[model samples]
Target: MATTALPAPKSGSAVTVRRILAIIGVGFLVFFAFIEIVPFVLTVANSFKCLPAVQAAPQAFIPLPPFGISCQTETGSVRSATEMTDGIAFNPTTEGYQEVLRQNLGKWFVNTAVFAIWVTVLRLLFDSLAGYALARIKFPGNRLLFFIMLGTMMIPGVVLLIPRFIILKQLGMLNTYQGFILTLAADAFGVFLMKQFFESIPGEIEEAAQVDGASRLTMFFRIVLPMATPALTALAIFSFQGTWNNFMDALIILGGNPDLFNLPLGLALLRGAYGDTLRWHTFLAGSVITTLPLAIIFFVFQRYFVEGVSYSGLKG
Candidate 1:
């Protein structure tokens, strides 16, 4: 019988190496997920528990009680061991929510919303306009202007604090909404982002519009701007988040007026006045309320925001 040479034995080492790598990758992902998820889970769980329960034993998963807190059992309601011990009962209370609201959370919410909306809208318009002009319009010092704008972005934002404050003071805009909104309404990064997105659109589209007797302004507003929705959406979301979370600038510009405090400023005020003895539940509740709008906005527009970031490669 002709002994056909049997194929060389497969390298078991290679298969073993791949298995090790696969195991490592899975382990890393599980570890990373655990790290990321634990805090959010803890926050949600703690939000449901009463102050004493959280303080007494924050690590506890089930609500302990004299408060009679228990989830529905398979055979109707069942009291947990925790429920029987504490004469206090476990139940969801809106006291935290009520306290946040009663403490002028509504005003802070409205202030943040207004600031974010105005800054976003204005930044979108101005940045896109400047970007389009820099990208497409030929004018004296155009390149220089673009370079200056780019250079401005490189300057640390913290460095601008004193200078910006001085300028605002000189301009008599201190403590005004205009001061806060306009301070960040035309960011260099936003302009740069818009410029890059505008550049990505083939010049052919704008040329065709021009050939059809469309004015530059008309083509930009009606044609280019409409098609740049992804970038604009991303810029808007960024602007909103930045303005909403703005604390230092608002604090410095608006002074210590409680009436003028934004969400972050207001939150900080709670801690400053009450110190560590402050109601942890109330503070967390306010945080939850403050975060909800941004979370909703992000989820709703996440696709566009992600697309814009990917396409722009802003850092790169």
Candidate 2:
């Protein structure tokens, strides 16, 4: 009977405020989701529309025929025709996709795939070897070299474009795959990423391998490298995406070589530059095709991506 009085029921205004905040939070989430999803939806929808339909109502969610009537003379009398909403006119066509293939989109796809694969593979191997040496092997000037490489990252990428072009031209590599791939074989960022991750591995593991009479190469390949799957996956994804979407470098290096044009370069060439008006429908279709590979890669590797984001390689 003497127990403290039960707390009073929450005030109506307080309950109302909580409800309002919850509603507001949900509304914000929905709004942002809509913002992100709408453009993708519009692109896919419009990709199926004919040029005339897209021009008529670019903002329309559905790729239906434009609201207009067609007139033609029949039996010496004028007749009118209108496409109903549910008519065959609303059906989508594969013309854009067909045209893209005819214009060597498939060749571009293969070129981009091969280029990205080589970049990812070679970048990983070279970066990992350099990172392991810098992190684990004690060599004169190792720290200085790493710091110098890091300093390279601070240089604006644009500043290097002219210099890189000149270097490639001097080597007679311009307009070749070697010109494109060699310059990007290994980047400072990848080396830096691998170094940090390698440093996180316990030295005891390498020491154990040494005690077992393992050579440095054996220790790295058989022992240390096996524990670095997460970091390797992350690096591979980064390299692939960067190389796949590369535009300016590909444009310059592969200059005017239609056979070597990647998706980005091919998409750029898709635009029709007659006096002023742009061919938007065809452009959107090509964009959809180009985006599919990236989307697939991300979805396949999303688990590694998540781990990479939160990975603190070194446990403090």
> Among these predicted structures, which one has the highest lDDT?
1
The residue pairs that clash in candidate 2, if any, are: none
Q: Candidates' lDDT values, in order?
A: 0.79, 0.77
lDDT of 1 by residue, 226-305 (tens): 99887888888889889999988998888656777899999988888897687765777788888889889888988876
Q: What's the C-alpha lDDT at position 262 in model 2?
A: 95
Clashing residue pair totals per candidate (backbone < 3 A):
7, 0
Error of 2 at 145 (Å): 0.7
Q: What overall lDDT, based on C-alpha atoms, would model 1 receive against the true structure?
A: 0.79
List ranges where model 2 is wrong by over 4 Å.
1-15, 56-89, 272-275, 309-316
Give each model a TM-score: 0.85, 0.83
User: Which residue pairs does candidate 1 place in steric collision?
Assistant: 65-82, 65-86, 66-86, 66-88, 67-88, 67-89, 67-90
